[model samples]
Every structure is written in C-alpha cells, then in structure tokens.
Target: MTNKLSAGLAALFSLGTGPALAAQPVDWQMGFQPAATEIMTQIRGFESYTLWFIVPITLLVLVLLIYVMVKFRAGANPNPSKTSHNSLIEVIWTLGPVVILLALAVPSFNLLTAQYSPPEADFTVKATGYQWYWGYEYQTDEELSFDSLLLQDGERADAGKEDLATYPRLLTVDNEFVVPVGKTVRVLVTAADVLHSFAMPAFGIKIDAVPGRLNETWFNAEAEGLYYGQCSELCGKDHAYMPIAIRVVAQDKFDAWLAAAADDVEAANRNLIAAIDADAKSVDVAANVKN
Candidate 1:
C-alpha cells in the first residue's frame, strides 16, 4: 500500500507540471525579426518545463473526475466517507501543493536569472521612435542612421514582384533594421517625441521607449528571417503607422550592407563638395571678368 501511495504521489506530482502548461509562441505566423536566442530559448524552455507540471496535474484531475463520476454513483458506493476530520489527510493535502510549488521554484528562478542576466554583447544598436517612423543607429559606426517607414499598398505590391517575399502586411517596413545572424545585439531604445514601446513577440522582448529616457533589451536571433513589430504604446494619431522590421542576414551580407551605407554617405559628401567647388569657380570667373 505504501509503494502504491508513493507511485500515485509521483504520478500526481508529474501530472501537476505537465504538457498542458507548456508555453508556446503566439502562433506560426511568418516571422521576420529573428529566431530563438539565449533569452527566448530559456523562456521557451521554462515554458516547456512548466507544461510538464501542468500536464500531469491535469491528467490527475481528469482521472479523479472520471473516478468520482463512476465510483460514487448512486448504484455503486452509496455511502461516502464521513470522516472529514482526519488531521493527517489535512496535513498531506496542505503540504502537497507547497512541495509542488517548491519544485517549480527551482527551474523558475534559474530561467529568470538567465533571462535577466546581462550577456557579453557583440554590438549595440540604438532604436529611436519618431511619430510614424523608426530610426536606427549603430553605436560603433558614426553616421549609421536611417528612418524606417511603412510601405504603401502599391509598394507592397511591388515587393511581391521580387523573388523572396517578406511578411504579408501585418508588419512590414520600408527600411529594415539589418543585423548579422548569431550575433549578440544589445538594443538601446529611446523615443524621439512621445512614448512608444519596442515589441517583437517572437523574440519575447518588449521595452518601453520614453522621451529623454532610454530602455535597454537584447536578443541574438539564431535564424535569418524578417521579424516585424510596431510601436505598442499609443503616442499620437499616427501611432498605428509605426512599424518595426528587422532583417537578419549572414555576416558577409551584413558587411556588404555596411559598405553600401558607407558608400552612400561618401557619395553624398562628394556631391556636396562638387557643388561647393562649382560655386567657387563661378565666383572666381565673375571676379576676373569684372577686373
């Protein structure tokens, strides 16, 4: 009887933390941002662990429900146990949940520490929110800034004409935040004007960007994909227009993009210098002609 009781308790404990309580992402929508990183992976892991407990608990409850229905029917065991004052039963029931909770607390604490612990980041990016657009800044590189706006319906149709298509419409942006896959990206979030929240559901990261204040978060995507998000906080009338898009590519692709951005800056500078030289030449010719 003791062995049977032990087996039952073990089964009950396992049932308490089982599959039904596993944590899953919202859904399998075509995600663009990135894949499970250290933080998100740990979160998902804990969720699965939590589900393990929930599954056995649910099964135990279900079994008890069915057992009560059949075993306590009027035609079956008509008389129920009237001894409700058993001190041992009371103590056992009271301590059972406490023990279960203690068991859960171990993994729960480990996961929390993993999620919150600061990692040895590889790069830092500042994500600033404007009225209806987002600005990205690379901390290590100067003049690495650009605005990301939402593509119009016509633009979306044009993008579809390309070979590889991104997320449909729920979260697409004209300019995407580009990063190298498998790199630790430390994000420093701030708002240019009003309050906005930088949220990417797949990454399990959401931080508020407030004016004059900076909030920080980090994620390292394992896979290369376009992930989308929006300014969750209602800042103004155009809050809905704000969308966040991220493109995680290979390291070589990231290097090429950086070079492209550098070339654009250089070209703009060259154009400005040429225009200044032309103005000076014109002034010199006019002065010589007058003399």
Candidate 2:
C-alpha cells in the first residue's frame, strides 16, 4: 500500500507538470477533450458503456456475413438449402435487439434527464451569439457586459497571450467568460441574428441558440483553469472564427475581476491573467521542490 501510494503521487506530479491539465484541444487528439465538469465525466462514461455493445454486435454481424458467403457459395454448394424460415434464428434476432435496447434505454434516459434537470444554480450568465463573436452579460444586480472577439496574432503581445502553447491561436479570445471555480453557473444562450450553438466540450454542453428563443444549460466546473471551445454550428461565412473561452478562477480573484471589469473589461482581463499565471508558476515550483 505504501509503494502504491507513492507511485500514484509520482504519477500525479508528472501529470501536474504536463499541458494536458489545461482544458483545450490538443493537436492530433482523436477522443473528447479532457472533462473538467461532472456532466462531461458522466457523458464520457456513457459513451464507453455504449461502445461495448456496439463493438461486439458489429464483429458478430461481420463474422456471420463472411460465413454465409463462403459456406453457401456456388462452388461450395450448388443446391443451397432453401430454409429461410428458421423459428429459432428469427426468435433470437428479434429478442437480441429488444434486449440490447432495454439495456441501453435505462441509462440513456437517466443521463438525458440529468442533463436537463440541473440543480439550483449559484449565479446566471447570459450569452448572446452574434454573427462572428459572443457577448456575455452577468445576470446580477451589478450587471457587467462585454463582447469577446478572436485574438489576432498581432494583438497577442498587447493582451499578454503571446505563449501559443497556453493561449492557442483561433481559440483564444480578447475576453473570456469568467466564473468562480466549483460554482454552478447557469447560462442562458440565444442568437442575435442567425442560428448558432454554444458548445464547450469540457462541460459537455451543446445547446442551440435560436434567434427568437432562449435555451438554458448549467455547468459546475470543479477545476480552476482556462477552458477553450469553438462554435459548433455553421452560422455563416465566419462561423469558424467564433471561439469560446472560459476562465475559471478562485472566488476571491473572480470577485476582484468582477468589481473592476465594469469600468474596463480589457484591463481587468489582463490583471486576471497575470494572477492566474502567477498561481500556476507557484504550483510548478512547489511540485519541483517536493520531487
């Protein structure tokens, strides 16, 4: 037990120093982005659960097809048995699909229900999708509003986002949706013009934004980090340019930024980034010392 615990700590230290801890799409990544919310974790679990039945059923069908082709070929058997109505095979086929459906239905329905039925939200934020950018409004007594545009290459230095590895191109933005970590945030999404979708893979959220309708979703992020996402819907010519960035910070830092963001959103964002960067460096140094 002592050896196992030590090995686990060592593995965690290695992971802590890696870039995978940050929530973003890694290059050559095939699977879903690393889950940062409970909802996303459950979604990934359900995906794995469904794959078990899918793989075996696919392999079984393929094997049966090959057997039928080889065994009943013209060269093998000129007079193939004309037994198309086998009661046993028919009953097996009918019952097999029914059983599989039942097995899948229970868990699938449960997950769907849980997705829509969120707990009491801590606070609310309204996101309005425009032609090529997103605008966020904090639904509080002292409401704050701002538009987040894609960060151009030339503006990276001014915004203090020059590190491509940390602030990826096409995914970073001028301002991010800021929220306190470990708090449930309900998002009301809608479109100002054409249809759009607000999707964040880390949160397992993909809700449509209609012009005349309001759709809502909720997420509670357990980790503190900058999570990146892109507009999944094809709204217009510049649909690909619309990216979403959410910065989850500690409560104290979030409070400070929120207080200052009303006056100047850009300056507040830069200060928040610096604070987060300082926290990250401190963590790295502490981990190295322990090692």
Candidate 3:
C-alpha cells in the first residue's frame, strides 16, 4: 500500500532522478560505452586504428582543395595546365590508394573473422523478439522461460526499482535476461512477428532476428551490471519501446535465482534484487570501514 502510494505520487509529480544511469550514456558521449567484453575491446581498437588513416587522409584532401582553390583560379592562370599526364604523379596517386586500402582491409577482415569465430559456449539462451518486448528461455537442465516487458510507471516502487539512478525510466524492464558473469553466454535469436535485430553495443554484438530463421551470437561479460540494448530493426510503431536488459551476476547468485525462478519468476526476481542490494550495501560498508 505504501509502495503504491509512492509510485502514484512519483507518477503524478513526474519525479525522476537527474543523473544518468550507468546503463545509460551521458550527454554528448562521442564514443561507445566502455567495452564490457573482449570483442568490444577489439572493436574499439579497430575504430582507433582506422582513424589513424582516416584523419590524415581527410586533412590531406582538405589541404589539396584549398590549394586548388587558390592556385588554379582563372585570374592567376588564364590557361589551365593541359599537362595533366605525369607518370610519377599518376603512379603515386594510384598506388597510394591501393596501399591505403590494403592497409585498411587486412584489419577489417581480421575483425570480421573474430566476430564470427566464437569460442565454445558454456550454455545457451533463446531470445525471441516480439512486437515490443523480448522473451528469454534459459536452456539449462531446468529450462525456465519467461517474457520480459517494459516496466510501467505505476509498477516502479512495487518492484523495488524506484531508484532511478540504478533503474532508469524506459530502460528498466520487469524481467531481465540473467546470466552469470565470466561465463560464455550464447544467445539464439529469432523473431515471432516481424524482422528485428538483437544488438548490444558494449559486447559488440548485432545480429538480425528473422522470423523463421535463427541467428546466433555469443558474449562473455567480465563485470556484473545491468546492460541495456534495444531492437535495431524497425518492426513496428513501438519498436522504440522494446528494450533489452540483461543482468549479469555471480555464478552462485545465478544458480539461486535459476532454481527459484522455475516456480515463480516474480518472487525469484524479488529475491535476486534483494540479494544484489544486500551485496551493494555490504560493499559500501566495507568501503566506509576502510576509510
């Protein structure tokens, strides 16, 4: 009853936190979020590697444009030079592009190979894309499956997720796809109604979710946190609202949650959140004690 009143008051007053959640990007963040996996680390590295070539080439092109604008004006040269055929200049221009393209292509091809060549997965989960939500199935020995939906405004405080800094509005879901940290998680992706995409930027994973076909991707999250993604393919009007949230926890915590979720998912979620909160509180207390 008290929780309901708080949620209602929050909704009525449009109350929310000002700071951006960790799962969210800060204002004007130019690069990707800090990489959470090895693949994402390599992706960031490749981006920087390409920029080394891109920046110099862009500057060179700009300088050539300015030089042409100044040196080849009609007043400066009544006749444009018809001597446009120099073998050395032609060879340099042609070979320079070839060298640059070859330099870019080697790493590009290697990155593509790495993205496809995933190590053996420890376990598998099925993620089915719906019109505006995601359904996940833990293909473990117990095989528990559940549909995850966005948390409505009225259900905030009741779920113990009223803390906006942790569970930001719109990004928070009722049930998140839970996995164990430091374990390779394989996701079988497909769609039920229309074409959608399963994309998680932090893990450098993006794959198409076709209706009848199943696509596969894998990620090994090193740190534990609430990671967020969204449907990359436009399926319907509510595509923007379809959010993907994954909770990575310790193996023991995951085992406990998995065992409890087989009977009641909601209760299992509540217990899991309670455990996580307790863990956080313990860490805070430890820090204070050290101080």
Candidate 4:
C-alpha cells in the first residue's frame, strides 16, 4: 500500500513536470489519451471490460469458422448431414448472446449514469461555439469571459510559444478554458452558428453544441496540467481549426487567475503561464534529484 501510494505520487509529479501542452494525439497513436479524471478512468475501465467480451467472442467465432471449414470440407465429408437448425445449438447461441449483453449492460448503465449524473457543480462555464472558435463565459461569475481562438502559425512567436511542447500546432488556443484541479466543473455547451462538439478525451467528455439547445457535461480533473481536445463534430469548412485547450491548475492558482482574468485577461494569462512554467521546472528538479 505504501509503495502503491508512493508510485501514484511519483506518477502525479511526473505528469506535473511533463509537457505544458494539453494531451494531443501523437503520430501513429491508436489508444485513448492518458486519463486525467475519474470519468476517463471509468471510461478506460469500461473499455477494458468490453474487451473481455469482444476478444473471446471474436476468437471463438474464428476458431469455429476454421474448424467448420477444415472438418466439413468437400473432400473429408462427401455426404454432408442436412442439419439446418438444431434446437440445442439454437438455444445455446440465443442464450449466449443474451448472457453477454446482460453482463455488458450492467456496467454500461452504471457508466452512463456516472457520466450524466453531475454532482453539485462547484462552478459552471458556458461554452459557445462559433464558426471556427469558442467563447467561454463563466456563468457563475459574469465578470469573466473570453474568446478562445486558434493560435495561427504566425502568432506562435508573438505569443512566446514557438516550441511545440509549449503550444502545439492547431491545438493551442489564444485563451484556454481554465478550471481548478479536483473540482467538478459543469460545462454548458451551445453553438452560435452551427453544430459542434466539445470533446476532451482526458476527461471522458463529448457533448454536442447545438445552436438552440444546450448540452451539459462535467469533469473533475485529478491532475494539474494542460489537456487538449478538438471539435469532434463537422460544423463547417474550418471545423478542424477550432481546438479546445483546458488548463487545470491548483485551487489557489485558479483563484488568483480568476481574479486577475476578471480584471485583465492578457495579463492573467501571462502570469498563469509563468507560474505554470515555474511549477513544472520545480517538479522537474525534484524528479531529477529523486532519480
């Protein structure tokens, strides 16, 4: 137990010291991004749970196909039995799938409930999707709001984020959606022009942003860092350009950022970025020492 706790703490520290950019897909990436929230952990767990059913069933079907092809070949069995429908086999097949579905449904329902059932949200943010960008409004505190535009290639140097590690191409934004780590942040999603999807893989959240209707989703980030996502829905020609960047920070930092952003967004962003860089450097130094 002690070792496990220590290893968990080490992993969190590593994540803190890691890249400043939000979680993005790597070249030749296949699986989901690293889970930074309880919901994402549950999502990964449910994925693994379903895999147990999928893998064995797929293998069973493959083995059966091979056996039938080899054992009942034309050369081996010249006179084939006209067994069209066996009651026993039919019952087994019907009951087998039912059992499997029931097994899957139990966890599936639980996951759905956990996903939809938002615990009393600490704060709510309204995300309004535009033609190619996102506008965030802190509904709880009307004083804070900003538009998150994609950082273009030419703007990277001006933003002091030339390195891909600090701000990834097409994924980085001018203003990120900031939330405190370990807090349940309820996001109300909508669109101004067309349909869009606000998806954050690490948080296991993907909700549609309809023009007239509002969709809600929540995520409580366990680790403090940046987590990235993009608009999943195909809204327009520049749909791919709009990316979602979220910065999860400690509670005190979040409070300070909120206060500063309420006054001046640009200055607040600069301060937040500097603080994050310093925090990452400190964590890196500690990790190096422990090594």
Which candidate number maximizes lDDT? Answer: 2
Query: Could you tell me every candidate's TM-score relative to the true structure?
Result: 0.66, 0.92, 0.91, 0.91
* Model 4 global lDDT (CA atoms, 0 to 1): 0.87
Models, CA RMSD each: 18.7, 2.9, 8.0, 3.3
How displaced is residue 33 in candidate 4, in Å? 0.8
| Local lDDT at 285 for model 4 | 70
Q: Pick the candidate with the highest TM-score.
A: 2
| Tens-place lDDT digits, model 1, residues 47-151 | 777788899989999999999899988889777767659899799889988998998999888877765676888889999999978998887664587777877
Whole-model Cα lDDT per candidate?
0.68, 0.88, 0.84, 0.87
Single out the weakest 10-residue window by summed lDDT for candidate 2: 13-22
Instruction: Please say which candidate is ahead in lDDT: 2 or 4.
Output: 2
For model 4, what is the alpha-carbon lDDT of residue 257? Answer: 93
